[model samples]
Target: MAAPAVVRDLREHWAPASAQEFMLDDVDLGNRRLTIAGRVRPLDDLTLKLLLDWLEQRRSRWPNTANLHLLIHNQTADTTGRASSHWISAAMRGQDAPLEKLRVDRQLEEALPHGPDPLHLAEVFGLDEKTPMRYADSARALMERPLETDPATSP
Candidate 1:
């Protein structure tokens, strides 16, 4: 499968583990929000709509699942279990480490454009302030560097 498809499948498989809940009603569609480990976060309109549609379809397919958890194994009937950090690391078994690179690229891009407000980054990305602060420092150093230009190559 393509990388994007793999990522999407992994994301869907991991959603219940990340959110720590199984009930479709746990998601507050009317408010366009979802809670992750007790922290409430707003959802983009597209995500909210897609989730609603998925839930509706799931409900129709499995009416008895209304009171049960959202993600259940088709054969085993077990809740989608959480993956260990070791499992995640093994899953990204590649020299390039695409997931790590994507995270770093996103942080740098966010920092470069905004001058790196660590607090803002923490709130917006639902991350710890320390991580954003580190990104902010990197951004500051990058902003201080002068661009190197060669006079010989000037047009």
Candidate 2:
């Protein structure tokens, strides 16, 4: 819950590569930042609290374990390895949306508010240099479209 929640809230990638690479040190609650894939992104209050609680539970369950991954499970708790990429999906099986969809929705949410600024999107999301431009273009088109009016009210 905490992992998927963070992914949805912060627009961070939780794909196979990222899921298998997350470390406890990547989350800096004191600084309210998460360093993932070389991107140091801010963490919201709700997400921060969730993480803190999760950490407390983790410590209680595996006090002597040496695993450093933030999302450790029953099988990976004792080793210094990350959970498999499918871990997020497995954990989110009954959730409203998949982790990937959450990330896309988050990107669109950000793009709508900050479109025409692909550079900002790319910088914030660590997207491929050209990827943010696509989202920016979509935002631009959506913004340019006229709003619908009721036929009865139309002149």
Candidate 3:
């Protein structure tokens, strides 16, 4: 199946620290969903296909192991487990600025045009309501700025 433009772009440019770290379980794939930091979300078709491919490759390499963990360094318990945040951060260093920055920027950008609905932003981004409220305040401040061309019409 053809991937979406955004998915294709991400696949081509950004390689995660460990592809396995982002792996999903059979249940998740079956439902075409994901749960991150306790937030359940739907997985797009392209992402689900990519995940299945990765899982197949991993299974081929270690057919005897019973490890159900998505990401694994080795078949042994000592090495096989989830990837660390530090490792993920390091991997993202040269690829882009901190992942948090990218996430915040995307969130703020999305909030800006829509008048910054804190509840919506929080739900969509899986962030605390306060976080979105902070960005909403900033967006409101920017909107309050007086336009040079016509101060009365500004904001």
Pick the winner on TM-score between candidates 2 and 3. 2
Query: Deviation in angstroms for 121 in model 1?
Result: 2.1
Choose the strongest candidate by TM-score. Answer: 2
lDDT of 3 by residue, 48-77 (tens): 776677567666877765566565444232
TM-score of 3: 0.55
Q: What lDDT tens digits, residue by residue, belong to model 1 across residues 5-73?
A: 222323432332463343455578788876655666666555566666656665665556423544333
Segments of candidate 1 deviating more than 4 angstroms: 1-16, 20-22, 76-97, 103-115, 137-154
Q: How big is the positional error of residue 48 in model 1, measured in Å on the Cα after superposition?
A: 2.3
- Give the Cα RMSD of candidate 1: 5.7
Candidates in order have lDDT scores of 0.55, 0.73, 0.55
Name the runs in model 3 displaced over 4 angstroms.
1-27, 44-50, 75-80, 109-115, 137-155
lDDT of 1 at 51: 68
Per-model TM-score, in order, reads: 0.54, 0.77, 0.55
Clashes of each: 1, 0, 0
